[model samples]
Target: MTPIGEENRGPGLDERITGALVGAAVGDALGGPVEGYSPDQITDRHGGRVHGIVGPWHGDDWRTARPIAPYHKGDGHVTDDTLMTHALVRVYARVRDHLDAYAVADHLVPDLMTNPRWIPELEAEALPLHRVFLAEKWLVARLAYGHVDPREAGVGNIVNCGAAMYMAPVGLVNAADPAGAYAEALDVAGAHQSSYGREAAAVFAAAVAAATAPGATPDSVVTACLSLAKDGTRAAIEKVCEVAGGHGDFES
Candidate 1:
């Protein structure tokens, strides 16, 4: 049994699910401020620390580094990653099943471009679906050939944590089902993220799924994530755990 399996020997199902979603959102928000910063920068700002979601924190310059929409400031507001995760959760609540690439694309891309819920910074970056489709015309062209380039299918917009951060909800919806969450996250993440970026999203999703099981602890959740993540993400998780361990509790 996984560490989560061992921990989840007590809590009710609803409690576990709630814990998983809350954990994901908190993790996303907490990590938002430090996204893409080098370990040195992170250490300098927060004293080589990992923090939980509590109060607002400042993020690095989005314009110079990640290139978010015009309204974006240095404040720690979540990017498209969290927003798209919420969108996926809404869709899953309606359908109560897994989603396909086209289904997620149909909802996320167009919505991000037009939705007022997005902060001004993100809204400004939204591209019309028609433009994205046209730019990736090969996606449609290759539909007949049974092959589509995932990279070409989405608009060439921000490639930061925007897509990955929000993907946690996918794992929550598929709680105790890591494989399913990984597959679904990849399908959606492939459209917007690639390389380490996509891998980070997938690992987060899988961790949420594993953490949703009853009685699961934060430690177990981190362990579960390590099994699936690679490169920077895995290293980040390790750093988070190390920092968490030194602290008395998340509130401290």
Candidate 2:
């Protein structure tokens, strides 16, 4: 890696960054239908593996797993991951630099409400943010309309991967600087997360910053994660990958 720069940088840096962003969107759509299904369940239902775009859940065992409204997901559609990421992207475009929690209330909320954009999976033009999960909607409502403070906006909400999942762009923007990315993600995640979920956002941003660094490789990415992760988080990943190593890649 020649380091991140406009001049005298290594080749393919731009492509890799583009790959990171586009790949996140495409992968989100592909994985949307099977979002909550176990690997075993997916194989059982799809008869080995999913190939092309699939429709909504057809099984009877899935009601409890779906969102309350559950607006016909899958079928080339994306979930909250893409929605939030896109909103954040727009905020970055406006700011043209790093951001913190206040940007969530200022830029993201209006984008979610007024902006009409095409949802790839839904294959329609609407307020793309309308498809966000209820929990996410709550954050926006609290910040934009409920008079909540930006720093305390995430209080009383469920702590989950909702934050960390979409923070890769922060890492991408602050590429090669894991600490800066982690700090920024932590600050911004406060608008929609607390406790472990906020911690996950920091870890994820750090991982992205490290992965997007010039000359980053798969092994180096794992190394970047292990360096920043702590205790059970690191151990759990090691154990899971150990089991995953024996399995062949699915032909999807």
Candidate 3:
């Protein structure tokens, strides 16, 4: 098992894991309506963007994968990020321990290929057939080296936030152990994302681990994210905090 409690321990074991997964899904749905659109665009489209839990979340546009429907325009639909997180959750439910790179690659690569329902709205942007083949090739390479060569792994048109967005669940399973979460997230995310993309995945994973601790508030989770993220990501988090703060209570 990926050991937790190397440092501060927060929640009960089950609660932490469950809370992390639930929180990630909630965050994804909360942000889904605003996905891809800038703040200005969102304001222009909707009189004012709802801060949290807006209703009538719609599927993303096939062409742009941006939320665009009237009234229900960009509300709270889950994305590939949350779907892949569920996939990881399934794997953890089965294994109940840390999985090596090859095992993770075996599960993830095939899922990416055949799981048409994983993220229905964004299927139009799924990896092309050739990239699927390449992913398989890199999976083999990953098996050989115990880690895929970053150069060979992420070379394709499939680059995006897809891999990073779903990574929170991995950290949830390894709650209170930021290092383990970071390591596992890096191993899995390496198959599909690199550079800043990989970094983003790692940060989110770390935050999940932190948030899973008992009594951890949203602000604490955001602080954990700030601790793990790089300058750009930290800046983004700051901006999000500013927006969240300005909105007062999000549920209102």
Candidate 4:
């Protein structure tokens, strides 16, 4: 292994970590309303810009869109993405060191269970994940009740982006050690995801850790992601960027 981005000379470690967390939160809130919309749809709506928090989509989009439970998320209401992130942060704060699947079961499961917060998407304050969404509720159930092994828990879960979507904090915590971050995230995410979701989570953590490197720039970050990402994830990103680039909107 090349040790991924495990270099110590990277500058502004604290700033990079903070940026990653805050950026994820802010971006989640901003993108929440537009989550289901396509790029063209987003452009047509919101005047091509989400200047601030807005309500759910309107008009035909609303009629055609998948049913969102108890609409009216209001401005800046966060979804399970941010909620999972905060739970992970609390776990890190308590452990104050590296984590594995057991730590995820002991700390993260409890955090998701007892820590009640306003779930804007669900429009209710309740236990995490499953209570938030039946699909997500599996995370807590498997670890807390089913007593499954954390490392293998994700084996049957849906193959989606749910795991990868909330994995940036692991990358930030591991900082320059992309490999370590990827390993830990893979372990932690196993309780909630499987297949492509698990793969994406590991790659996302690696990318974040890689970006936290000293003197890291935008191009360098993309390079790191391409390097660390494997198989489908790597090829998908390259192809998407290349295709998206043709439209001159890859950055959008």
Candidate 5:
């Protein structure tokens, strides 16, 4: 295998980085409104598969809606996913090096608590902490307030994608280096996730790293993820691929 930064076979580094970042933000915005809806629900609500940006699920009642109230979810608004992605980028900028749990404690937690930015969903500028869900809030609660060890801070939190959602930057930083990305993500996500949640974060980062590699293909990325993934994460991806293998058309 080519060394991480030594490969020069596919898109240039600049292009790959730009594509990954822009793609993540765009995808996040597109998925915001239909985030928790079932496929059939999304299709029904959009009058078909969503082809472009749409309005909040409850339209004018968005502010008073029962479940998603007080936050606008669509019309190009990004959810916490993109907010955390941007925060990871800022952490990368400040550190100028690979990050770990300590970096989360020293940089990311502070940023979420102190930085007030334009929250599209909120349609207002506010601290990221205000918009992030309770899972993310665990970071500040555990690290800044509880003063738990960064590496073990995620122990009692719910196991979910709170860490994985923003891990694209880890993959990008470790571009072309799936193994490195997986290891680094394990360390970084340790501050925010545990069990399969952390495993998913590591695997997703590896998948991104593999995708950014020179001459990478979808199959290659999947192979890299399968190789590094563990427990239910591996089984779930395998099952998805197995089920998908029977269908060639995504729109069917």
Candidate 6:
């Protein structure tokens, strides 16, 4: 196993882990308020591109706002994405070992269900369960209530990004080892996702793992993703990269 704090001639593993986790939280906070809107819509609503932290979409009435009601999704507040990421970090801290589906059942589910933590989006202290989206709630339902085996719990849930969204930790734990990250993420994600969703989690973990390697670059990360990704996931990434190659910048 790769040492947790190994430094392979670039930033130390600890630094990479901090960068990845902090970056994920910041991006989540920035994106949460405009999550469902298109880029054009967001630009129009914000009177231009969002360049920094902004307020709730509905301002003072955010508590009663439709669609985003009750959740204060802006002003540097992180949505459940960051919350799940932190939860996964705690899981790793407690386990002190690589995790799999059973680990999610034994540790993650209980953490979500029993713990009352400060939830930024809710602007109050509450159980993580209350803030979790439906797909995530499936973890508790299947394992805690439905008595489903952890490895198979994800079989019938809607194929979505729930598992992939917070999988950076898996990649971090398996730093510089994209293949290891891919395999481990597949096992861990089996508790929450299947089919394309499961595959996406693994591929995303691999991308992060690849990025942590010494001298890794965007091209290298994409190469790692292509090497490990499969089926529609692979085709989709290839198409995106192909289309992206024609553009000079995001604004194009």
Candidate 2 clashes between residue pairs 3 or more apart in a chain or in different chains: 76-121, 77-121
Task: Compare candidates 1 and 3 on TM-score and give the better one.
Answer: 3
Instruction: Please report, as a residue range, the 10-residue window in candidate 1 with the lowest summed lDDT.
Output: 128-137
- lDDT per residue (tens digit) for residues 33-78 in model 4: 7887788988887777777877777532442455754544436767
Give a tens-digit lDDT track for model 1, residues 181-230.
88788777776566666777788788778877765677666667776767
Q: TM-score for every candidate vs. truth?
A: 0.57, 0.81, 0.63, 0.81, 0.92, 0.93
Q: List ranges where model 1 is wrong by over 4 Å.
A: 1-11, 19-81, 118-159, 230-252
Using TM-score as the measure, which candidate wins?
Answer: 6
Candidate 3 overall Cα lDDT vs. reference?
Answer: 0.61
Off by over 4 Å in 5: 1-10, 246-252
Q: All candidates: CA RMSD in angstroms?
A: 8.6, 6.2, 8.5, 6.7, 5.1, 4.9
| Ranking according to TM-score, highest score first | 6, 5, 4, 2, 3, 1
| Model 5 lDDT-worst window of ten | 243-252
Q: What are the lDDT scores of the predictions, listed in order?
A: 0.59, 0.76, 0.61, 0.76, 0.91, 0.91
Report the lDDT of model 2 for residue 53. 76
List, residue by residue over 157-191, the lDDT tens digit for candidate 5: 99998999999999999999999999999999999
Q: Write the per-residue lDDT of candidate 3 for residues 8-74, one digit (tens) a residue.
A: 5544778666766777777877876666778887677666876776543333343443334222323
Q: Once superposed on the true structure, which residue ranges of model 2 sit more than 4 Å away at CA?
A: 1-11, 59-70, 230-235, 238-252
